[model samples]
Target: MGRNTRKRSTLANRAIVASAALILGGGGLVAVNFYASAGEGWSSGPRTQRAENAGQQVSTIDCPEVANELPREMPRQARGEVDRELAAIDSQITDAYKKFADQKEQIQRDPQLAENAILNPLKDKRQASIDRITNAIGRGGNKPQGMNNLAPCSLRDDGNDQGDGQNQGDNQDGNQDQGQDGGQDQGGNDQGQDNGGQDQGQDNGGQDGGQDNGGQAGNGPQDDDFVDIQSIEPNVDEPQEGNDASTGSFATDCGVNENGKFNPDNVIVAPGVANGAHHMHDYVGNQANDAFASDDDLANGDTTCQNQGDKSTYYWPVLRLQNGQNENDANADGGGNDQNVGEIQQPSEVTLNFVGNPVSKVTAMPRFLRIITGDAKAFTNGDANANASWSCTGFEDRQLKDKYPICPEGSQVVRSFKFQSCWDGQNIDSANHRTHVAFANEDGECGDGFQAIPQLVQRIVYDVPPGPGFAVDSFPEQLHKPITDHGDFINVFDDNVMDELVDCINNGQKCQ
Candidate 1:
């Protein structure tokens, strides 16, 4: 048979099989629930009816409707530019998915090859597209005045590609193999394929291949080995106590957009982590951000924070206040109104500070030093050596035992964290992405084998209302706990900026 003919036959067979399974497994009614729960407005109408309604046929899973909403939300003069840019991004996302679907068979056959050939390039392209949109938006304005508080357009593909028939076959294979394994001790052949296939599907599904069974596992680091936070002691080794006074400090005010509206895009939950951030983050500095964002990407991208030359990317998960009710709680039961609950009211002000190292003097930080403060996987997994702290602005000495703190009316909520700046001279990153760097001793000294660089201290103060209604939105598995809140930084400063930073710290000169 001809290739196209064979493809059609395969699709037909898969559809027939899917229908059979739905009926046999009593998923016919469940499919309706799936359509409703998918949140994309998919319906269980007849296939012909669905096809007839082009609007209904469009999958809204990973698609961003920002462009469509922008025309209505933005001024007429700015609409054209924003629409054009968003359209290009939408097209890019669609094309990328199509390309992946077209090459699904080859990718599934050899996942690594697919990563090189398809995934990496697609990631770069997507990042570039995001950068373009951000730049376009930046040109229009910095503040969110009169602008609709729209969430940043996201390009996520959660292993739900409907364009590939072969994916269905793979899913069936996975299900069959998993069933046969059935907790039995096998020779590892079947288990290997099942695990390997699932991993590949998850790792490359959004970039290089098609869907797997149902949804992908998750995008965050696997926490299967993580112990409960209560079981682990919090890192009481405070880096700030008795630390040398800062020689210099640089601050950037990242208050809500020009119109005094918080841009959800600013706080991106996970820039370079897989599966995107399980929680929302407030981002500053880098406009083109994702799990695949490179140093070059950040240096070249625009910034929402002040000081354009300071291209250092900074981000942290947003904190929400938990009222007596679960209405706004970010709990695991999905019973709360946590959607955008972390999106606080336009902060009275937002500031990101970079302080000079107290101990080390005259040298530039290595490019792309990925620094994370506090543990993103803390609280739940029994192992909680978390260094994150929460307190009210006026009552800094009073630290809260719970991750989420209810500050008094006169004071603002604050999340303050200090990153490990001492690097292991040679490596830019290590196995855990943090082992190469060590926190300074309580006496403001780097440990042996580690060279101290300029310290990075992130202090975020929010003008949150005093109430039990606030909470940070988190991954369903996180159980709406605040302990999982974390921050990430990627040094994307220009060479001159880096040198100036080095000089400022070394010379013990204060700076803004």
Candidate 2:
């Protein structure tokens, strides 16, 4: 979504406050109630047909009829009460928005490349505000104790009345339809293709490759097409399931490969072990030192607070860098009521870059796909270290390197083999840097029957090398090996996908 569009949601909340008075009057209140009913069905309060129609469809926008009935001014006492309550709601919403703006400013200033899992709850709070404002305006009768004095009650009633008006319109339309069966018959004929088109079809249902027979060109197999076709090859050598291919002729560290999708269920996590650091983030000392130290703390379990991190510094997950008090924006607090904090400088604590590009920092974006089990949430990632921050505690003796150095204690670095297909510039960068599996606990849904949170994800990342006709799409499949520590199996779609991949590689049908 564009930034402008995202900002509109905030403006919507402000509109609720402005329209409160018009929404509270008798007709407006009824309109609001119609749109804000909690669920389906109605109670035996009144026998009016209007009430029945008001139960269908709720809209947060537009209440012209309700506006006509609202009083020009409420009593002084009632006005004061409304003002105070509105102010409180406004304050709460503003505070939330401030934090969010601050975070947004902080992210643009940071330089690290680790993805952060924080800031998620704040975004959720913003969405809840929208729902609250809408719901408040819909239920004005018998206001709740704390929120009773607000103008939202008046607006809510307006929604109910509007719904009733719409129902009346629908009934009129229905009456018109009852008087004309001719229109309905024509509409049905247009909806279904069985009327006049019947003559275009043949009586026999035999497949003749005819257009009218529901078989179009380029769809089914052809008679002469299979003249040279042969049966698919049968597997003559089948190793036990989960077994890796035989040792290679040479000691190779990296290659490209295609197999199955990554599935978290097959993941077998070894005990926590330290993986060597990749200079994914730029800079060794200076400003980025603290961020690195913070990361070390999390890895070593030094910070014991559950769901809490080094609160002293706010880390911009996007840059995986630290921000000082002044560098952070004051508006990103997740509510739309705060003043916007424009571009701010990167905090002194954040000084790293990924691949020389600041934007390459792997700040953990909110997951578009997630699975939550009970109170736990799980998600997957392909770029694991984009938003990592480290602290000073473990930096003294730690040696920085990319990939796991010794495969931490209790962890075994097993190998698997499959087909190789390196199309598009598959070998451009670290050929070994292919993504296969990832499971995370940021949101919770541990694997089935297993208490450990589960998240599985995999994707192929490659670029076509510079050439006249070379492009990502032009790249062909090649044989390669991609390994990941997050999950046991890289391909989750089918366990046997790897088998076919390996066969394709051995037959030289794919990449080498």
Candidate 3:
């Protein structure tokens, strides 16, 4: 136990201290890494793992079966005549929609602008179309019963007059009627019943308000008592203006068939309701497309578009201008239940265009991108819930809040949409069918950390003869309201075609 033993013991102790430091430091480093990663916008977890299998490359296509049956139900002779006459009417309607769309912003700003710039000309054209249809059917009147029943907007009532509590239009003024409990008016006029009461002179009797003042006094319960109006926080990142930036682009005529028929295959309606969209859709690109078409079906089918190699299938519901019946009657019983129910006409043309990213060169688009623009429930839910642009072909600057835009002379109504192009580089869709991809920046660049692909620009042109007579044939729940009109698309490109598309975008070359 001399100098040599003491040196060995000191060395062993030093080794133990060094080992302990290393273990403790390693544990702290691991914890630091976890928190740092989470704070680095990885809270949702690693993009690859979190986004894996979040979307499907293929979506089922199912057009409604009812749409196909309506045309066949008409007597052959009458069908041919009605179709011919309706075509003439549709042309006039198309012109009217275009003009209205061009001045949509002005019209919305001033009802006078709508009357002069849109309503007047549209009424004349619509009347002529109706006359021709009536003549073809051997009806002998300047204003046929069908046309009279479905009067033009200018000729019809505002629909605000509610004879009883049972019949009432929307409160256009946004002011609820004053009555017992702040409900309808006590008298038959000035807005119907009160306090949710259907009768004319029902007393409030301490239900909502302490008592009724016989249809007088305080406008009943104040709106603030039960309703909380919350102000939506503005999205700091929301673009204040439209983005016009684009790199390369491609165009395709995907809305019509070789015979120029507006026939799109059905896909999904309300998530799981396949073929539930009770209207016709025009399909192009993939010949094997149907309501239940699969990715393999799309890839293998012959394409109608210019680039036969790119087999992406695009489709949308056909916008029909009702000829004779109200929307409720037309869509009642089943869309195709009767020959005299309503006439469903096709569009003169449909166009589909694809524009690429302005900044990064597009890599290959992930196969099978399914996107739905505009809400089919917009009629009931309102335009605020819709994601569609209604405008005119020439006047692209003006946008409309309603689903259909009435056009002025020399213009065409157009429904245009630009789909999200930035991809997470993994999933084809997300839980919302939108999170897997995002809209490009205001400068037309992809979001940070996401890859850019070709932006889908879909333009659907419709010639709805101007007048109140026109309405879309929709699901029973939708009541065939024109505002419920919407569009959907699904991409089903072959691997080779997708690669070529990617190369074209990356190289900034315009393609077809």
Candidate 4:
């Protein structure tokens, strides 16, 4: 069965505040919950009507997120086996997606063909993998229940090429759709006054083969995935601060990936599994990093950070131009083989800024603290954890959540991330790869049990040909949607550096 059906680049979190809000709001939470109502059916109207349309097309696969179902305290001994099994499940889904994409037409014509040939077989494979995970986790006791629920995958009917594009009401859910369209869609492209940067895309010579998702490597991006940046309203709000705010800032000079460290491995989520992320990632800060790198390896690894004492690892999905081009990984596991196409673009600037909390003194992050600020599966999983934002240089006040910004000529595109700033004070990691760390509240205070730590406001700028012709790498299933863009960090700072950082923040001293 062919599995490659091009769906709408998910409607995604509407009009989320850009990273400028983090700085202006003094490290406020990105307010992800405001967009979490998707699963609650609030965003189901457009999809329901679309699904019932006789002409609707099943574009992508939708499966349960098994990781979110794991016990908070998984048996320590079962983690390895569980992680491997989970990775296997992901691979099973990817393969199924491939088959489905290949035969979408045949399956579309004969609905039963999908169930018998693809869905059923996939369920069986996933069930087996889940069973192994259950056995591993329950070897000495009771097994988790309802795991079968995670095995039933479904097909989504996107109905037309986005049914008027990605900014359609569904992507905005109920609240932001009207605001986004009213505020920007009509704002005119006057702000897109290109300053000769139009060649950023045409410079590729030609956009021949439609091998990319719009300008990507897979089944996404479509034309609706981009919007003119100048059209977006200035939405960043100044943050409120408390008298006890840490109030200091520090910058770590980690050069852009000039040394060319790249990989698709996610040690925190699928350790020991190569190409676990299914997309290319640009690495900076630490030289020793991969699916197999252990904490010890990271501790002793060389760093790109100017401060050698800070061996922290920082990485994120690489952005690519849709201008049909091939890179070294074109045929590799995380590249074309996984449907992530186009020529990879290097960042013109990468800034690692550690900002102080607005309500409390900051503490040292535990060594090896692993935190993920955005959801890599956001295209399918919803945007409860999506914290990244997009904008253009000079237009930083307006950030986009779901749509990629079409920068005017000479205006570079930007990706920004404000990493979670609260720690649980004990564990460095958690079962689901989150949960151990949390974002400060809108008021900049950590929760009852969480302590304030340095908030990493990461910003990456790309001088790509200005327009909507570029996309960040994403899982094949995710379709290169901007919402799927995410960042990863592993704090390998030695004790001395950590102490120094903590002191600088608490004492309101700006330290490099």
Residue-level lDDT of model 2, residues 1-512, one tens digit each, is 01211111110110001001112112222211111011211121211122332222111111111111123223333332333323233333323322322332232233121014223332344335434533443354322233222222111111132112321010111110101011000000011112111222323211111122321111111110110001111112222211221211111111121111111010011112111111011111112122123323323332211222211111111111001111122222210111111112112222111010011111111111111110000001111211111111112122111111111222212111111111112111110122111222212221222221111111112121111110000000000001011111111112233233334333324311
The true-versus-predicted C-alpha distance at residue 130 of model 2, in Å, is: 22
Q: Write the per-residue lDDT of candidate 3 for residues 1-512, one digit (tens) a residue.
A: 00011111000110101001111111121100111111232011211111222211100111111111122123334433444434333333334433543443344334476567655665665566555555544432232244532214331111211123221111111111010111211110111112112122334311211112222111111111111001111111223222433356666655455433232224332222233343445555676666456666666778777766667766655443322222222322223321112334445566776766654566667677776555454433333224455555565554443323344445656666566677788766442334456666565556666777777777666554321223344432233333345556667766777776666655557876
For candidate 3, give the lDDT: 0.40
| Poorest stretch of ten by lDDT in candidate 2 | 472-481
Largest lDDT belongs to which candidate?
4
Candidate with the greatest TM-score versus the true structure: 4
Model 4, 1-512: lDDT tens digits are: 01122321211223322111111022121211111121321122221122122332465777777887777678888999999988888888888888877766566667788899889999999999999988888995578888887888877655323223222011212121111221111100011111112223332221221233223333655434566777666877545878898878778998998887888788888999998888889999999999999999998899999999999999999887655456777767887778777677778899998988888899888889999877777666665556688888998888777667777677888898888888889889887877788876666767789898998889999877644457888877776767667899999888998888878887888889
**Model 3 residue 499 CA deviation in Å:** 3.3
User: How many pairs in model 1 have backbone atoms within 3 A of each other, for residues 3 or more apart or on separate chains, i.e. clashes?
Assistant: 31
Q: What TM-score does candidate 2 reach? A: 0.15
- Across 51-97, the per-residue lDDT of candidate 1 in tens digits comes to 12112111111322332222212333443444344434434443444
Better of 1 and 2 by lDDT: 1
User: In order, what is each prediction's RMSD in angstroms?
Assistant: 20.2, 30.6, 29.9, 11.2
| lDDT comparing candidate 1 with the true structure | 0.41
Which of the two candidates, 3 or 4, achieves a greater lDDT against the reference? 4
